[model samples]
Target: MHQQGAQAYQQTANVVASSRERESALLMKAAAGLQKIKDEWPDSYDDLKPALTFNRKLWTIFAASVTREDSPLPHDVRENVANLCIFIMNQTREVLLEPRPEKLEVLVRLNRQIASGLRGM
Candidate 1:
């Protein structure tokens, strides 16, 4: 029954989620993951690398997509997204270097804010 319900939810999500919605979901998921690590602090320090890597990769893809020549986003919007993605990548690198709980704050906030914007919230 659980498996069936999970499948149903996946199907519904695939049908109803637009690109922006999907992006928002991914960002929120990333933010949640990072926040968990932050909340856990030293205990979750070992989880930091994997979380940061996931976020960095996500931002990299977003940067590439926005910067692509055929991207449908407006020039200024694309540029802005690309810039934000770059900052995310850099911040991820810093967190990786220091592994401080406080360093995770900006990443979490940015991801949540970006997700909210994507959802038009």
Candidate 2:
């Protein structure tokens, strides 16, 4: 019984580690996509729509996750994340409408910061 309990705990830990890794990867990917736009700037104005769309979708998923009743994050943390998501959504809309290279910096910074936070976790 003791060995079985140890095995179960190990399995649970592995699953959690795997989930965090995947989350980190996804955040990195989003940050990279934003960075590409930053690198190209006005020269890649055409890419803005798709990049912003992708980011919006990503934030939407995050908002949904954080808002869920089953979310494991502390209440204040969840609230803060949800608020950030709302801000991201609004900012994304502005970027979409204006499509300015300079405007993308905020998005890039936010994604990298979030990715860093995830990695820290």
Candidate 1 lDDT by residue in tens digits, 34-103 = 9999999999988889888888888989998988899978999999999998899888888877778999
TM-score of 1: 0.84
What is the Cα-based TM-score of model 2? 0.89
Global local distance difference test of model 1? 0.89
- Which regions in candidate 2 have their CA more than 4 angstroms from the true location? none
- What is candidate 2's lDDT per residue for 1-121, written digit by digit as tens? 9999999999998887787777777777877887888788768777778877878888898899999999988999999999999999998888877777777788888887887777777
Error of 2 at 119 (Å): 1.2
> RMSD, model 1, all Cα superposed?
8.0
Error of 2 at 20 (Å): 2.0
- How far residue 66's Cα lies from its native spot in candidate 2, in Å, is 1.1
- Give the residue spans of candidate 1 off by over 4 A: 1-17
